[model samples]
Target: MRKFQDYRDSVHFYGRIWTAAAILMLLLAPAAICVRYNAWPAASAVLKGLLGVAPIFWTTGIIEVLTYAPMLGTGGTYLGFVTGNLSALKVPCALNAMSGAKVEADSEEGEVVSTIAIATSSIVTTVIIAIGVLLLNRLTPVLENPVLDPAFDNILPALFGALGVVYIAKNPKIAAAPMLFMAALFLLVPGLSGAVGVLVPVGALIAIGVSRVLYKKGVI
Candidate 1:
């Protein structure tokens, strides 16, 4: 217990430092661009844009913390936050790595594995993105081919579909509730597609609540 606790503390300490540095580095790029080009927007314009988007970002950030932190734990969660794209990439990568290794997420090995997986994913994603950017000119014709559009459109669905199948197989009753509701919601209110980030957490909350009820009633 003492050793794990100490490890947890150290993870938190360094996680926070990296998270802060990531934020600073992210902002520095834009700040440097504005300085170099003398292209700073007016304060009012910046505030206007923030007003339009900040609430959505703030809400998603809070929801993600509440939803993702528990599953991801301290180190993976911090790394995910720094790297960004948790819902689409890092969370899946970390969870899949842990599952593949047959490690309980709360175990010492699981924590280390999850963090390493998240970091490795971030590195891989960065490399892929760099390569894409470098070869973008050469790849543009092939990438923009009309035949490939449908495949590109389905990429996200394909990734999540595989995950959904595993989850439904594990516990059909618990998964069914959120899955059905989410399917109906998007079908009925197509506008909510733009709010998928907010809605994903909402669906997770529904699943959690349904599972709790099922557990209490011995349904699971």
Candidate 2:
């Protein structure tokens, strides 16, 4: 018990330090850019731009914290949020790693696996992105080629399709309602497709509600 407590304390201590440092570096970059280029926009204009997206971003951030924290554990949460791209990359990478390791989320082994997976994914993504940027001149035409357009457009669907199959197989009861709801919603109101980020929490809430009702009735 003492050793476990020590590990937990150390994780929180270092996680806090790294999270603060990451935030400081993020703020410093924009500050440095504004100072060097004298490119500061009007305060009101900046506020207006922020207002346009702040609600959705803030809501999603809160929802992500609630939904992912239990699965990610402390160390993973700190590093994942710092690295960003949670939905598109970090979360999926962590989940795959944990699944491969046969560890349940929230367990000690799960915490370690999640942290390692997210950190590795962050490093790999950074390296790949850096290389892509460096080679953009040569790669742009190939990336933009018509032949690759459909594959590129379907990447997210393909990824989610595979993931959904695995997860639904494991928890079909919990997955059923939300999957049907989201599909019907998109089908009925195609315009809502563009606001998928904002709708994530809506789907989450629906799933939670369904799960709670099922649990109360001993259905799941």
lDDT (Cα, tens digit) per residue for candidate 2, span 28-127: 9989999999998799998999999888788878888887787688889999999889887888888888999999887888988999999999999999
lDDT for each residue of candidate 1 in 1-220, tens digit (9 for 90 to 100): 5698899999999988988898899999999999999999899999999999999988988888888887787899998888889887888888889888988888988888999999899899999889989999998898899999999999789888887787689889999989899999999999988778888778888998999999999998
Q: How accurate is candidate 2 locally (lDDT)?
A: 0.88
Give the distance in Å from residue 178's predicted Cα in candidate 2 to where it truly belongs.
1.4
> Considering summed lDDT, which 10 consecutive residues are worst modelled in model 1?
159-168
Q: Give the residue spans of candidate 1 off by over 4 A.
A: none
Q: Give model 1's clash tally.
A: 0
* For model 2, the run of ten residues with the poorest summed lDDT: 1-10
State each candidate's clash count: 0, 0
The CA lDDT at 45 in model 2 is: 96
